[model samples]
Target: MPNLLDIELLRTFLTITETGSFTRAAEEVHRTQSAVSMQMKKLEEMIGRPLFERGARSVTLTPDGFRLLDYAQRIVSLSEEAAAVFSEPELQGQVTLGVPDDYADRLLPRVLQAFARSHPHVELVVRCEGSSSLGERIEKGELDLAIVTKCDVGEGEVIRREALNFVGAREHATHLADPLPLAAGPQTCSWRRSAQHALESVGRKYRVAYTSSSAAPLISAVLAGLAITILPESAVRPEMRVLTERDGYPALPPCDIGFLRARHARSAIHDALAHHIVTRIGNLSPAVLADAAE
Candidate 1:
């Protein structure tokens, strides 16, 4: 008989590859790092090849690992689709979801509340993090679904994408001698990266005055005049000064917002929730674009 490959182990492998950190992968799967490591070892032995190259503080998928990723994603997606078609009765299952911190504050609460009201028996677990982190969690099956900025969606399916804009203090002058002082999130934030690149593309020098993964701290930094930051228009408050013109400063390029669902585990609750977010966000797009135009 051919060597058997466990679907669960493959799912774990995919998570480890996407996160590039065993520790984070373990956290996503709700397993200890050691256990995750052991599962990988078992998987490698069963396959007769190492899937990832291990280092002291980092990990990367080997060619074999990359090859497995495509299959893993497909298998997981098919499994979910099968469950969706065959499962009976109303959807009732635990759904672990990931959302970017900024969206969590401005948009997610309403979506979750609505979902809870509609699916009263479903348990909802939410994790708020940067887009990159959320992507990793979603890939690993740690999250049943995710709302995040567009980044590496991997070979997994994409549900929807929205454009993001740069938002700053309304009263701040556009002309600055130094690199624009920026209040931003950690390095993994897509908005922060977009802001820096936009400035650099225009030959503008900018410094990060504040960096925090949390939206509250980043927004506080912006409000305190420590620095201006890029944010989605939906996240901007009416009280703050905003720059809508592109005269002195670089034009903030649009970033994509993506909603994703795990291919492997199909949950009707997650599908419904994803649909809800896409619909709500679509309804808000015109306003978001209008704000950016200002």
Candidate 2:
């Protein structure tokens, strides 16, 4: 008989991909790092192809691994759906969620739609704030759940990895200015801090021509060629273009979108909402979202 792909192994594979490292994936799957490594070896042996390209500190999917990911995700999702139909309850409660302004437009709608379909009785109270503020609220037990952009490897299930890009209006020569014009949020924002740090590292002279806590005006400033700003590639507007090293911008570090659940009593409703958020984030457009775990 042909060796079958175990559901548990597939789950492990998805976890590893989503978390970017075996160590993190093991924590989520309740396995030791060596055990996770052994599982990957077994899966690769059964499939007759290596699944991940191992790095000293991180791992990336191989081409064959990427191909298998789609089927694995579908299989896992269908399995969950089947189980939920029989084992899950009709969850009902008000769940408070917080998201950063930059991600609100990109990730919020899908999460809302998924929750609406899966647990219609659950009411979603969402707060839009900077990631730093959201993290603080989650820590203070003021929220049921929050999706936050972490500057470092943060707590909770890792969903998506975001590469910060320097973006501005298309055909805009604002970057050519001696003291580059920039539009950014307050210093508390990771985007602004990373942008400034990158510029200062290279000894580049820059000026914050526009600042806004909201996404609307920041995008407007970039579109109007008033300044360039650091943003995740997914958040870039249609009229905006990413400025690269050749375009006189420095590379920035990658960040992640992770969730934090309050350390209080949980409900089936909360779990359902969290699941929906993860699924939606995993389904983001591949072109813009690169190096994500799931």
TM-score per candidate:
0.59, 0.74
Clashing pairs in 2: 17-293, 18-293, 18-294
* Model 2 lDDT tens row, 123-234: 8899998777777888788988888776632566667887889998896877778799889987767778889999999999999888887778888888877888878866
Counting clashing residue pairs in each candidate, in order, gives 10, 3
lDDT measured at residue 234 in model 2 versus the true structure, 0 to 100: 69
Candidate 1 residue lDDT tens string, 92-199: 878887887787777777677656655667788888887777777767777777877766344333434444555555555533427677888778666777778877
TM-score quality measure for candidate 1:
0.59
Once fitted onto the true fold, the runs of candidate 2 whose alpha carbons sit more than 4 angstroms away are 1-61, 82-87, 152-157, 282-294
lDDT of each: 0.67, 0.79
**Runs in model 1 lying further than 4 Å from the true structure:** 1-90, 152-163, 170-177, 283-294
**The 10-residue segment with the lowest total lDDT in model 2:** 285-294
